[model samples]
Target: MVENRARGNTANAARPGSDAGVLVVGLGRFGASLAATLDELGRDVLAVERDPDLIQTWSGRLPLVEADATNADALVQLGAKDFPIAVVGVGTSLEASVLITANLVDLGTPLIWAKAISAEHGRILQRIGAHHVVYPEHDAGARVAHLVSGRMLDFIELEDGFTIVKMRPPQETHGFTVGESHIRKKYGVTVIGVKPPGQPFEYATESTRIDAEDTLILSGDTVLLEKFARRP
Candidate 1:
């Protein structure tokens, strides 16, 4: 929401200029949507695009650099160092993504969110100091697989030994508030949230009751959750 433009350096007053306004590398569908979303939310968005056409298209709406995001020198000349938070959204070109992520890390970006093509790519990004790495497609596919496999409702991987999962409530769970379920002792999983049919889900309170059709967001080991998900 940087309404006041002070010279070439416009400080996002809300987040501050020093806060590392979001820097998005790459200009594809995902990149465009992300940039547009930020702009809509009054966030100052600076982007780097390797493709000339893409850069030209978004330059008017956003601060775009029509150069390879992989080049440190090129980015330094174009104001990349000013931002601390960056995302490498180059999905099609794996080479560019790797080099650009590496270059950003070298630039000392405090928070780097990189998209990985596979687990191997994720490992590479992690090794290079990427704050977090994700394979959106792979993760989504895992959820879909679970649905088809008829196990859990939703599965989210957190740190090791901890996971956030939604389980299909059985008849026993019906008419029981979260506190009454004794979830922690019974399932060895902590019920952190709940999702009931035809209703929006939110963090589960002690009073949150479990309906037969409700899905629970539980946190614990994946193995036990899987076992619970399969049990009748």
Candidate 2:
């Protein structure tokens, strides 16, 4: 398992706290990104996947467990119940996803987040007691459609139901400091990050300026988000 000790900041994770260790079963893009981001924000990670090569690649990067998360006993062996939160991220494989969700419920894995392929799969996850169920592909497609329409760049929903969105800076808010533009005041969206021209996004800074080409990643209510994104 990988553990980080960064000073000052408390951890931010999709899983709950109290037990620092996090078990990410399934090392697909989403699982891998989730593990990395959690570690980047300083949480201990214990990652698992059925692919031997993928496990080998990530071995020791975190406590990489080479096992099929779909197996009930395997997850227990990997100490999944030791953590407060667990993520079941098997993609496309409906049986595997269902089995893993069932396993977590059977083992009483406190908070389980599962990825599903359909509405039916979502129902099964709910039946098995998944704390959260995500249709990542659908969600991503929605954001991409908006982006393709030149209306948004990216969108992430933090656990609290607050939407975090990156979009082509709106006309009124372009070319202003975060506070000067008053995104919070006018749109009620918090300017969590801003990308300036020819520069990478300032991910967690408020003082960053909003340039014409800049994309703003904001956090706020969904209604307000839709309002900001819709064409005038």
Per-residue C-alpha lDDT of model 1 across residues 98-120, encoded as one tens digit per residue: 88888997897766778777776
Computed on alpha carbons, the lDDT of every model, listed in order, comes to 0.74, 0.74
| Candidate 2 error regions (>4 Å) | 1-15, 156-232
Cα RMSD (Å) between model 1 and the true structure? 8.0
Which candidate number has the best TM-score?
1
**RMSD of every prediction:** 8.0, 7.7
- Superposed by TM-score, candidate 2 places the C-alpha of residue 17 at a distance from the truth, in angstroms, of 1.6
Q: Which ten residues in a row have the lowest lDDT in candidate 1?
A: 1-10
* CA deviation > 4 Å runs, candidate 1: 1-19, 56-63, 126-131, 177-182, 193-208
Q: TM-scores of the models, in the given order? A: 0.71, 0.66
TM-score for model 1?
0.71
